[model samples]
Target: MRKKTPLNKQIYLSDHYTGNIAKTFQREKDINILQWDFSVEASLVVKLQIESLLNYIVKNVKSKDERRCKYLLPLQYLFRYVKKNNITDILKMEIRQEKEYELFVPKEVKKNSGSLRKFIEFCRRILFISNKEIDWSANVWYVEGLHINPKRVSQGTPILSFSFLDITNSDNRKALQEYVNYLICVTSMKMNTIRIRQTYARDFFRYLEQCNLCIFDVDYQITVKYMKKLGTQNLKSQSYNIKLNAILEVIQYLQTRNYIARFEIPVLYHKEKEIHTVNDIYNIDEKLDILQKYLYLFPETLRIMCLVLINTGVEKGKMFLFRDTDFYWEEGTSWLRIPGENRSIPIPSILYWIIIQYMKRNKLTFDAQLFHNERGKKYSTASFADAVSKQCSKLGILDGEYIFKGSMYQRELCRVLYRSGTSLQAIREYMGYSTEEVVKDIVGWKDEKVAIKTQEFFEDEKHNLGGKLLMAKHDKMKEINQLESLHKVDFALQEIKNYKDSGRIISVTELSRKTGLSKGFFYKNDRVREALDEVKNEQKEEQLGIIRKEIIDYSLEKQLEVYKRELEKTKQENQLLKRENEKLKKALDKQTLQYLKLLAET
Candidate 1:
């Protein structure tokens, strides 16, 4: 009979490893070891794999839960069952086969076998191949494995998978690796962006494999076929555009680097299916009201987060990056500083009060994360969004009616600010955007409202003015008949020219006083009125012309100053050159005189 292996000996219990998760890891080991059975050499092998997985979880898993030791259960059960049945080989077991899994795995441990399968997958991806520093040829590549930080996130790190590449097509896989590395090292693209681009590229690679082609074989026809395939997937217009653009960017990169021949991919623009009617505008207001009313029902963290989002329009990714010091009081108003921006936006006093209370309740420090999960880990954007969605759903809010996305709150805030008469420039500054282009889109509906109201106002005023003019017509006719009988046309024309020359205000009253004509005659006589109006316009034009000439003269003066400065610089340079020329000539003359003297002496 074989000697029973000690549990402690079979599994590594290094004190140094205890420093990874400190107390939680040590406690988990103590609790889990009580459940461990006899440890054979096969069990030792399985434990080592489990140790590696645990190390990965400790370092990379976003969850702060302490019960991560459960991942070890499935492997422990497998190795014990194998030893009990006198299995010949531990490593050769077909755990993926349904019959073999059902036979080898116990009923209690079967549920966790999925996690075990993940471990096996992890092994196949990382270990089974050449056990070097980095296996570039592997199907899955981890950002950490390539010695990249990839920026820590509340969500786990990004992993790039190349399994879509055909196994025989190692050349394509290598090219893909080079492209991804270029994105990481040369371009320094955000890891999330790189991951998404890799996903798009992978989908294209998978499509190429189906068509029995490779990346190097891409051309205009392949692009068309790929687009047709994407069309069949029933993707939304914007989503389809993004995927199309991502693939095109990859193809362009491949061509730019001379890996593939240059070819034109058809430039396609996606038309959005969304059309905002008046009803949609009404719906947005209704949703904003609903959000404010039912806000108390949200989870505490999400509630404060949404309030900040609605007020400041901070981006989702930057939402959780806020520190307690990010909020400060300036000019007796509370301000929130945007991360990575030099500016701060004012927040409502009530919102500020709420945030302060929340900070006090949570006992957050100056530099500590203001928003975090229950375990004091920063909450991922996806997790926070899901939480908000779930809460809203519980309150009978449908996704179509009002989703609690961060961007939705942002757009709504922009709409509110614009309607409150905030300028686009101010909005851009408050939102920490370099341009107002996106803000214009969010607040664009207000322009339509303004235009409609203005047209209605003008239409109403036109009708009222027409009625007033009709009522005053008889008095004007009586005055016009009197003026025609008096024959004062020449007199009125002379008075108008005098007014123009003296730069006096030309009106009917002034003309009536000078020419002894009725004001109504000046108003009603077409020729006299035309002459008066022309004189007034000419005077205004003369003033404007004087101003224009002044502006032109000032501009010419500026140009002249610039030319004079250049001329002065040129004169200085010429003087320096002349001095040097004179010095050289004197030196040459002196040398000639010395040569002549030397010839005389000879």
Candidate 2:
């Protein structure tokens, strides 16, 4: 039976940006009398003509023999139309249907077009008619349906053949189908990925057919030739690279199985992904702008998702992978685990309340998967991304430079902290990435301690940065030629010294702006850093020498004064002793005069 809304079709339409049609398909349940399977046996000619389509659909949909099989619903109506209109009679069909079809019995029809456009596409696949042979004006739905040119997704069945893949080689087609099925079931790949791979495979296979070659004939040279043409597309490096890799994977798979020769795949360098700088981390204003919707107006589901993404930095897949038990909320404290991130992290009270309310509404228990898609199946990437995307657009915050994924949340959140003087280590721990490098790549803060140390000099309003800081260090000016390896010990040291001498450093970030180098660059450049250290030591020694000289001058002056006082006192004492000696001699002389003999005897 036809579903209320087809999940795979929703993903298909969303990925193609097939916006309103999906709603049209689901909401406009205009007719209910149509059967969902063919009752009459197909004529021999019709059966022979649709042999491949039938075979493909049979393999693709296992419930082919069952009544009301969802995939067969559209086809059952198609067969009824074919027989009712006696369409086999063949008209010039030179005139387009004003509307695609007008059902006879109920005399009702879809306002736009019947499912004729889809039927025609199915016919083309069955018959292998080239695009050029098809008449565009014959179908009323031509513009609305075909103009968008949604890719014909491969269904892991050998129903349709690309020109590049040999039409006569039934084995190749079967193998490709088997491969696609394996990818879907065993690889646990996402549906969107399956569609994309299908699209890429079609393009590559068609190109191979044009070149008069097959997978067996493929080599590095052929792939290189293909890439040279691929390089012409106006996609961004990242997008272009992803497309290239998709094709490479197909070829690589073939090579791994010894069906083709092995070769190294080319790699593209998208400079923007290198790492987010401190700048990519947003300031308070930006953070407030992004987070305010979650705080107040967004739906509960979206709010909780945004909160978790903002807090834990987990991607959509892993964010949805969590069970209720992963969240530990009780009493006054709360935390949750994002598997593979290694530890639990504290959550805000508001988030806890939101999750509890959501769980209660959904009747979720501790063991239930906390999130799911609309069909009550496991959470799907396309649905979650679409939900987030719509909200971001409504807020008028979507930007071409950044995608609003979980990683972007991390970058912006970390940026806010970085701007506010939060340490890198703290931000990294909070972000929950396994490696510091991953945090650094996402938000480039190389050293938590040194990253923002220079901020104080710029913080003080009274100091003239050019005059009081760099100029004094350079003896008067900010000329690069004049200062040779003199100022950098650590990027932080200059900031530290600036803070000490001038009592202000606005931010390491501001100093980084002044120097026109990333904060991480100064922190990470080892070769230049060693020289910077030597220069710092030299400056320290010179300052120490001047202090030492002043102390020696003061000490020597005091010692000289003490020596002079001691000499003077000694002289006075010697004079007194001399006087006493003279007195004694005079007395001796008088005594000698009185008693020359006594004196001589003495």
Candidate 3:
């Protein structure tokens, strides 16, 4: 009789000597956590094929969890189907999306909505090809996958996706489509930036639709309308400026393309309501004491989530998209390597240890996600942010005026960097700010590093013109002309803003009369016009709210009556709950006697 092969060894190292995940890796990753027992009976040749496939998958795949999750179950199903059918060759087993979709996406499964679609994407990523090399994408994915587009899965407040189809004008629709496809997708802009642009672009387009105007003929009037709408919003001044600037960039892009008439707009005209001080950092000793232990003792998902945010200044949305593979370790250093970013963020040594410990506790192989729930799916950014916020609130470290939902990490990290005397460029790089000024502003760094040293230093034309022999004189002229034009416009805009900041009313009549400027000039100058209109509209809304106060009072009276009724109903329900609790307590005592009697009899 032929000697029987060991079943467990047969599963991984049959005739397929491609390699094991541990031995195959040249760089010694601490992957002992990935080893698992395996035992399956199969034909020698079939086992060989299985081993070969597994090696190929394990070698190329980033996460052990993903490799096993996507392949192992399917492979088992294939083995069962083949053995039951008594097929000579196991290669003929093929998965059809239709039946698989039915099995995976059915409501009978535990709340796994659209998981079949996710599976389809997972399949696409791995490329479901047979050993014979079948081109399945041509038949399966391209045909069925055309309709498998993901819904706008917003991770957090900032990553908003807009449906451009909402725009009614054909020209506007075409332009916006091109903007999304060509400008956003094809260009080198970051994903967060792209999303921000999409949000405000949609807002601008929707505003245009409401006014029954076309973007191709976008003029100064509708921009004023847009500014006026923005002015009445409940956004904080910084957030207000961020949104306004994002929208303004797109408007500038449109004007640059000559699709719309050019206009200048300032980010914000609002004065600083409160001065920022070092006191904003708040109770450093208490926060560190809480977080140091909390970071180690908390659940793997929460600890690693907080650890990453604190160490690396990645946005929360990017954290949601993290796979365990993204946590790349080399030698002793660990890096959070997100796609599309040029730099690999080095994790702090202490946090790296914590991260590894957390991963090991959770039994995370290279296949599992870094920040997923027990179900192996990520929570939304908002959900994660709420968790962070709640924890911070309990610690009394939560900022009263948070700029972003999940800003605790960024704020703390910036504090550490600023205190460490890290350079503005380095801070900008870490925080992913494009400009030095932005980095300074966000971190509240009170330094003139990004500011112009002296305006008079480059007063001479020759000194201003660098030794770039290729730069034509006319180019310099163009630059100077643009600056002069922008300066003139900015001065007027700032004047309007200053007037408003001083609590001076700036209506068309008031502004024109005060400055002795013509109404036509005030209305014609786009920057002056928009700022003036925003101030007027805000004042008008204030007056309107005052005039409408009686209606508000009547509504409040009705609300008060409703509140009283609700309070009475809630009190009655609580009383009913008390009686029900007493009944339940008596029943529990009766059940205890019955259990005691039964146990005594036994």
Candidate 4:
């Protein structure tokens, strides 16, 4: 069933898509032609995807019994819908897009949406292998599909979708896929995490497209705008943080590859995560007391296991796998060797005696299962915890809810030990953890209120250096040096002012001669140097001002002479106008007299 082929052979020819898709895969004997319902109206790219997908399934599906149409139907339903809706880019299709065709397809294929997701995951991987960037450049990828580890993901493998609200650019769509590739291959992000990341990434891509921006155009300001956009959506603080982290990861990747410049994003949107305060840890003691009150209700083995869990707070997995050699005596003190820890933590004396008694009564050897079911098989962590929760429910704790989950007791114990004055290093070893971070969170190591108080204390004293000096135990030698320097600076400044007032040239040499201070004092002392420079600058400014005033006065005198000549010209023009008016009046009077004489003659 397994056939090894060259990586090049696995790559389908892009030219093969031009011809009939059926004829291209007719020679692929493993493919069942009847199962494929290729409509005549299907476009070229859709036809190519359908053909490539069949070939991929044939190569990957190993057992003959598993090669059924049901396994292929989910993607087929998706492709048919894609073709019907005239979608050209399969890479832009989302996992939940199949729901659009739900009314058109049978309910069985709807149930197979999970399988469709797995197929999409396969597509993403193969796309990465083909282009090394998940660009989806080719119609098909040249790579083998491997099974995902079931233990890595819970609730089946999580799937990602690329269809965003406004992702119109083809390259940006491919870039989103490339980000998915980075998450999968490079970061090994869990599918559940990818799903969450994909949500924010989709929002980001849609945002970029809506703003008519590409990845290269993203900057701190652009991210600020994006944050404002998220803010407008009225997202929760935690949800907003997820959005920030998702976009930050994308921005960092683009910057690393030189697609965008690196810039710091303001963490204004950041809100502190809710943590278990010391009071919360104290409150958990009430539940512990309840469990202790109902301790005897369980069978002896379960009761002892419950007691050990509550007292030791070891990880459930390691506790379930505990053996006879794990418990020992060190210098008359009882110690329990946690698996994976270099040193052992001391156990309660009474609990230690009970464990020793249980081991002896069971006749357990050094590698034998100390705690087991009736069949003597090792008990699972899940089953052991379930038993504890069931017994607690019968005793009426937290309304029948299983509150004692993974590492709850361990976290509680870490906080308790830390508050009880145990060092972080001791707590880390006690909890079988490799670092203090685990216990750090449980103990609320970074106190925001304390940090704020410290900051305020520093800020208050920041400008109060006088008070600091006054309160300090003074050294006579330091004070004398300071006084001498201050005296020299004062004397040099006064001499510079005297030189300016008396109209004398001022220089470092003149200052030194007047004040009997070293010439270096005027140059070396900051205050003296500044005062000297200021006086010299003022003198130069005064001389420049005088010269500027003389220049302005000369220009004003020239302008006054021009105004006098223009006034004389205006007077001559007015006199000419008066003479012309007199001549016209005389002519009118002579014409009137001539008309009067003519009238008398008639």
Candidate 5:
């Protein structure tokens, strides 16, 4: 048989036990005595008497005696104590019935009764009341020292509170009182993003509290409630869904703190139609013109920040991290280096100059933050959002509405540049995006025309034709020089041939020997031999036609050169004639003035 584990002797006390055990016992004894006739008549005298005794002990036992009372006393012992004390006939029957109930009750019910029985035992052990002579009536009457009213809690308690009391009391609390202030005072996020984050966080918490559940016990029902509430509030589905996501983050935080047990948060779906519609470029231009008026009053840092955001589409938080060292300016190229991803973005020269002017006007030192507050601290995302909202409101752009920071503006600028023929790769590098999707969204195109044009411009046959023409001209000139030299040699050979024709025969081998020419030299002198043959055949029948063609080609080249010179002379004459005509007109006007003066004098 397996050995049974012993039961724990420790007794737990609940809210009921704030008084002395003796007084509680006496009250139970008195009630039992008064109700003895009814208890016996109903055959429940013993059960009723024991129940009263158990209630008394649990309610009034002192902290020290509480444990002993719970574990030592038995129902039979209580009956023996009543009999030994010679308790009245009325009480005897009632005590017997209590003993019978303990002996015959179901095990489960008896186990519950055991707590009361244990309390009595503990009282007996602590009070040193002998089991044989214990006066049940006297013990019951000794109930003067008990008091049992519960204390009321006055302050409101958070249903899902954590121990952030110390944090609340901290000095940073003043700075962190508002979401915007916290972001500005503690973190290095842009003001605009901080506002966005704050709006999301607020919407989330509001949704949570709005549902009547504690943050800890937020369930599917509460989520459903929030969804219904959101619908009733007439918020755009997208905006509502965004707030739901932000709220879910807070719920996740709660889960981390052991406040909630399950991960069953509901996700909100947004309709496509709920997304903000974009206006035309004309409206954007008008808005930009209105925004420019505020640049004079706003700090230079904020002015440049707005321009950079509108032009570049960098996230507001990322813009806060930008430093002067991030900019690379050399050889007419200006690029900004983004950390984290290590991407470099080329900026427009015009925007670069505007940023330089803004920096100079601010009297800021080089390497100082490009976008900072009066204290030279970067604006947090929330504060930047608030500032943007306020500026938009002042310009009548927002009109108590929320507007996204860079998306629409970036899309518009990208489209304009793309349509004007900027390359896709250039746009990708300019926008600091890792992928081309954003660029594609901004400027839809099958291919970049500028890149194709640049490629063709550099490598096209037409562009290389000038170099080819120069090479061909040089080759032709070299060939002409070689031919002329061969013609001179041919004339010398023809003179020797003339001597041979006059019966003074000169063999080729003899001519080669006389000129000290080797076999290789003879082969190379074929051009000279050919020229000599042509000279000899100059008066021969049909061979003169070939000579005549050569003469015609030489004459045509000479005429072309002469024509080019005549064309230059004609252009000069045209210019000279124009100048002479202007001078004659001036002289005529002068003579006419002189004649008019003479006429007036006459």
Candidate 6:
């Protein structure tokens, strides 16, 4: 400035040297030379000038230390300037790379490798720097100064994985297994049903593991995938949907534990169209026949149990509750009284006779159970199912894998009944269904035949005859409508005339007000005209009544005259009969005297 130095060179030297001098001088300086104040417009001009000066210093300063000094100079100058101007100041500065700034950690950090890798990747992406250029030793300084808690962030993925493993290993999983076993043993549920529950649980755990989340992370996508997988098995919609409910139960369990945050499982898609056909029943019957043969030859009570199931369609648990006393023969009806619900079903006469015959042939007492094993004890449900399966295999009826227990057998029976032309209402009653719709679902029957028959009934020749009779009646009624109206009008008119004769002019308004007739009556004057006609009708009816009375009286006189004539004729006949009787009696008496004389002579 003393020699009129170039503005760029002078500003650059001032910026670069001041930072160095400040660092070297420390707190020994009593006077401050860096402070400067400028006017508002001048201040803006100076800021731009300082920015230019810093850029020049940055370009010109070659050494690493010099460049760092150049970077710090603008901040120091701005601080001094703010103090001189009494301006509120905020620091806006970019850090220069220093040798000490680096992330230092072993390349093979065993404990938190995944987290460390992720952190490195995060720095590369967020700071837009190459991995090689990033220092690995820096602990306090971050390039972007972003304070990411490594311990917190790094714990998520591993902890989530461990949580999933823990659940799979826990007693809850054991409980689920126990539940499956119970379903198989006690509930008469199929292996397929158990398999469905297992698969759902496995998939749920897998989903949690893969997503690095708990069961709470399950979403629509995960559920959809599970459904799609089930769909691939080509299961019937109803069967598939029933299995889906088991899966939902597992999800509900997780939700109850607070492990699952959301719940929106899809409901079974019920198809209104009937999918079962006549062939399905035939197949079921064939299976039943095989099972029957096996039970017969094996001499096991389970066979009789299976036969009972096929015959009665009772659930497994309910069947197990049967006792010797549950069966009774009364009034030609052989019935089984179920426990709990206290419902009873009359066995088919044929089945009833068969059971009676079997009991008699086996020398079993009337009070003895119809189904008992060699052990003389009721078979458990599982043992019963196994016996049925063994018998079915022996009979060579292997069309499809059959579950010995569960609603499948009952549903199959329903299908058979439906195919056999059983009415839905009758089926519902027989099956103890709460609603007809449930029977329809179990049977998978369509009401198309009923619908068509209904439509035909309404459109048949009989309906046409009824329609014609109704139409004829309607026409006759229409013919009497005018007469009926005239009669009503005449009555009203007579009343109006009486009113007029009494010096009370019944205006339309007054008539309406008194009779509560509508305004339309005034518009057409129909009421007034009808009233006039009513008077004529009344006079005519009076005259007709007098004539009718006279005719009746004449008829009654004629009837009396005819009665008198008949009475005289009757009296003449009676006199003739009396004369004949006297003549006959005289002849009888003479004959009797002669007979008496002859008797005396004998």
Q: Which candidate has the top score in TM-score? A: 1
Per-residue lDDT tens digits for candidate 3, residues 566-601, read: 899999999999999999999999999999999999
Candidate 2 residue runs with Cα over 4 Å from true position? 1-169, 174-202, 210-213, 217-225, 237-290, 293-295, 321-323, 330-332, 339-343, 360-379, 389-403, 415-430, 441-443, 447-602
Better of 4 and 5 by TM-score: 4
List lDDT for all candidates, in order. 0.64, 0.52, 0.57, 0.63, 0.50, 0.51
Report the lDDT of model 3 for residue 438. 74
TM-score of 2: 0.42
- Per-residue lDDT over 224-310 for candidate 5, one digit per residue giving the tens place of the 0 to 100 score: 666566667777667766666655654565566565566674362422246566553445533554465555655566778877776
RMSD of each: 22.2, 37.1, 27.3, 37.2, 44.4, 49.5
- Considering lDDT, where higher is better, how would the candidates rank from best to worst? 1, 4, 3, 2, 6, 5
Candidate 4 regions with alpha-carbon error over 4 angstroms: 1-69, 72-169, 177-200, 206-222, 229-249, 255-279, 292-312, 315-395, 399-402, 405-408, 411-427, 435-602
- What does the lDDT read for residue 194 in candidate 4? 67
**Which is the winner by lDDT between candidate 1 and candidate 6?**
1
Candidate with more favorable, higher TM-score: 2 or 3: 2
4 against 5, candidate with superior lDDT = 4
Maximum-lDDT candidate: 1
Arranged by TM-score, best first: 1, 2, 4, 3, 5, 6
Q: Write the per-residue lDDT of candidate 6 for residues 1-602, one digit (tens) a residue.
A: 21212332222234445555444334323223232222233344335334344444344555644333333333334434444443331111112111111123223332323343333233323232222343222221232332222322221011111011223333343434444434434554333344556566665555455556545456667766776677777877666766577677776666665555675754645222336643334455445555554456655355456677888887776676565456555564557786556578877544544554465578775345556555766555555666656655665655424555446677876765775457888777777888998987676445655787776776554665668776677568867987876774665566678765665534544555565654334334556646644554565465546544543443355457568878999999999999999999999999999999999999
Per-residue lDDT of candidate 1, residues 378-479 (tens digit) = 777667766777788888865534454436667777766775457899988887666888788777855777999876764563455556564367458758
Model 1 scores worst on lDDT over the 10 consecutive residues at 150-159
Worst 10 residues of 3 by lDDT: 139-148
Model 4 earns a TM-score of 0.40
User: How much lDDT does candidate 3 score?
Assistant: 0.57
Error of 3 at 216 (Å): 5.1
**TM-score of every candidate:** 0.51, 0.42, 0.38, 0.40, 0.34, 0.33
